[model samples]
Target chain A: MSDDVAKFLDADIPDPTDFPADAPGLRQLDEALRCTMCRELFEAPVTVNCPHGHCFCSMCIRTALATKDECPLCRHAIREVHLRRNTAVEDAVRAWGLARTFVLQVLREKEEAKAATVASKYFSGKPKSKKRRRTPELSSDDEVVEVGERNVSHSLKGHTSSSSSGVVPCPICNKSVPMQNINNHIDQGCPSPKDADLDVLLSPSSKSKGKQKQEWSKLFQGGGAGSATTGSKKGKGKSRGADQDADPLPKIAYDTVTQKRLREILEELDLPTTGDRATMSARHSRWVNMFNANLDASPSQRKSVKQLMLELRRWEEAEEKKKTRAKLDAKDFDSGQYQKDNKTTFARLVEAAKPKAPKKSQSPHEGPPASSLSPSDGDSIAPPRRTEVVTIED
Target chain B: MFEAGPVSEADFFTWEALIMGPKDTPFEGGVFAARLTFPADYPLSPFKMKFDPPLFHPNVYADGTVCISILHTPGDDPTMYEAASERWSPVQSVEKVLLSVISMLAEPNLESGANIDCCKLYRDNKAEYERIVREGIKAQLGL
Candidate 1:
């Protein structure tokens, strides 16, 4: 018996290359595997007596179901004693695996042969030179790249000089122009190269939210800065430098409303917040980063992403609050619109807004029954009391 | 020693009897049989039993009778009815009753007997008592 098992394990497999490229049997196995409920490789398999030859895991067929039951795949009723393991099916599986390995090996050999043919043509060829090569002799990287339809002279035909300030590389035509022209290149793939510097001053003054404009003048006038980097503080007044008056608000300020939104975003994202001073600065910075990412989107796309974000924020708030039952305000009811329904009023403009609860329509299928809430049934409303006395010594 | 027996369980249960007459006893050279018809509540109550041929032994009754120990109803013999050993118990089987009868034939305890006249006859007139018992055995055997 041991010898027989060893023989079975070492059973010779035929080369799968011998089968045609479109072998029907391989296709059948793929189709069969797709149909298998476990969607895994077959194990101790059994075939019921049904004519279609549907197979199943033998143990599943035997124990996962009832005694003397029908075959699941074919619906053919069978006796418990009649179910038999199909050793022949296992032999087919082994043969299939061997065939697949042999076929893959054959394909690998074919690919190697093709690679050798391509190598011989490239490595065995001689290089071209300026004199020995004929006029039309081929094989030049520069000429081939140019011939790949760069048409560089024609590409620069209708344009001259960069208009924008900082140098921006044009992706196509391999040209470096300027930043303001990037939108032009992206829009029409051609940038007018002029008017570059006037639109490109560092406008810390123009962005003057509060005292920022005066602070810039002090920066130019040379203030408390260590060096006389500014021209001179020579004739400045008793009042401190304008830079001192500056609040140093960052270029992007998260206003109270946006800051509140930012905290909701961070909390929704479940980022860990440290209670110590060391991370308090980082937690504040993270709020700005998440806020700008939502706010500074292109104006058209901005509304939807922000809306989705806030609605998702609301859902997350609802989810986190789910563990505790909602407390109804003892004095407060939803006078319903006064209950912050306006924040959601803009939401309906976007199609994905949460639908408001429809006004309570008293369909017969719904609402309080007519039998109830009537004055005659008022006395009947309260449940009867034949209270059973329950007591415990403990 | 007496011991309990198997429950008599069947549609209609019967007891198998095999009694022996002891030697040198007044009722020797004879084997007798008696059927004890017990009610369902046998040990809680009494049974009606009698011998085929009545004898004139000290423990036997005035009629055709075999009076032995281990056959009285349950509880103290309130009438001071019979010797304590003669009353029945749940543990007493047919075999134990047959053995008791054999022992009674050898040496009868007449002090606590039901038939007072037979007890007196055995003590006063042993020859006459033996003769009448022998005659009863003969009639039973039809010899």
Candidate 2:
């Protein structure tokens, strides 16, 4: 979990090698990386079994499944258990998180160097033609140096000077300043840190962030390699014979086991056992998946058994609510009650559906045009349109 | 998104899109053009998808407006034919809607069809339905 926290903490550092977070290009990239639910860079990204290829963070999907068992983007049926961690997307986001600042810094420095060369050319006593030819070489040399610095930074743990000269590149501004004056340059010359950045990085809430990360990582390591493969293989099993790798949890045969034994098992796992036999079996199955899945997560994302139990309860409640809602919906559409409530509306719709004046050319099989389709039948039991131009605003 | 963009830069609310008829369907080889009109409170509510020149499909109206469960508003459905899960929510984007429309074209929902004639034709006479839809596609392309 320290690794996860370290990654975030590193993001707080204003590195000269990175792009400004607010740059237009970075903003566009941010949009692509953001989860639709949280509107933040994806954390534990999971792709649903929807045809639209929609992705949501694990926490977001859990929250969403609490209310609806469908894809948010396409309204296709989906299950939290069926969600596959989008490792490719997760890797991309992780890579971007580390590389954004370095890439941006290189681009900024390159542009600045080009501007400096142009200014020097104008001010110097050199001929325009000679300066033009030399400027291209300088710019190309600058790019090579930038690339070299990037390669060095990736390989090295700490910053390294490009030259052994007394001057060293300031990590904050990427400016070559005397090694002794580097601290002075950062304190006096560099621009003040943005207020938003300070608020996020220096906030009091982040004080205990390290502790939480430690706890999460501890839980993650407990589950071991089987859990890791289960997390990765869960969603990739679209074809037959992949079910064996889908669930890491050992399936308990609730039917064969006595109720007392099942209750004991739930107690040993520290899961709730208040439900009936059927409910208990379902609850236990969900808990096993949740527990093993948490093990598959990175240290920062692993959930405690208590949290998993709560999630299981929420899922059960949502399922119960859906069943009741379906029952109510069926009851609401009772033919007798519907006709009694909308008799007048139905009469008008039927009347409107009839041909206004019989035309010999019109065939019975040819349905009425959209304009003639009764407004009542469009979406709801709304009143029929009396005129052609009765456009209802959404 | 779906090889679709706004018809004009100024009016982003309305978009002109071209959906390549999905493979393995009667609509294959046809490039169907349509218009998407998004509401101001989009994502919260679904946008309206209408074919430029009417499409002959069970789920599509004669005036080109498409009627599918995905386009319906979230929450309690007035028609009760669609489950709440099947309806639109704030998370739905224009890209998802277009993809759903394309899939709908390939596999029309005859149960709650917007076009009764097309629905009957599709159920009782699939050959005729395919022919009519193909002809409509050809007419749209002036072929």
Candidate 2 chain B — worst ten consecutive residues by lDDT sum?
A: B1-10
Mark the 10 consecutive residues where model 2 chain A has the least summed lDDT.
A381-390
Specify the highest-DockQ model's number: 2
Candidate 1 clashes: the total is: 6
Candidate 2 wrong stretches, greater than 4 Å: A1-33, A37-98, A103-394
- What DockQ does each listed candidate score? 0.00, 0.12
Model 1 Cα lDDT, one tens digit per residue, A1-394:
3443344337432322334557567545643532142333344456666677667654344432332255544445664455455666655553454345445445444444445444543566644333343533253433444433333333333223332356755433224656566556544423223222211221344443344233333332332341333224322111223212222123223344354455444343332232333333334443333333322222211222222223233332332232222223223546565646666655656555436545785542321233421222111111100010000000
Q: List the residue pairs that clash in candidate 1.
A: A161-A193, A162-A193, B54-B64, B69-B86, B70-B86, B70-B87
Error of 1 at B73 (Å): 2.5
For model 1, what is the error of residue A47's alpha carbon versus the real structure, in angstroms, after optimal superposition? 60
Identify the leading candidate in terms of TM-score.
2
Give the C-alpha miss distance for residue A184 in model 2, angstroms. Answer: 13
The residue pairs in collision within model 2 are: A17-A101, A17-A102, A17-A105, A18-A101, A18-A102, A18-A105, A19-A104, A217-A299
lDDT of 2 by residue, A35-146 (tens): 7755546767888888887997765565566557878767788877678877778667656654665566555665555565556555763655454565676764665566
- How would the docking of model 1 be graded? incorrect
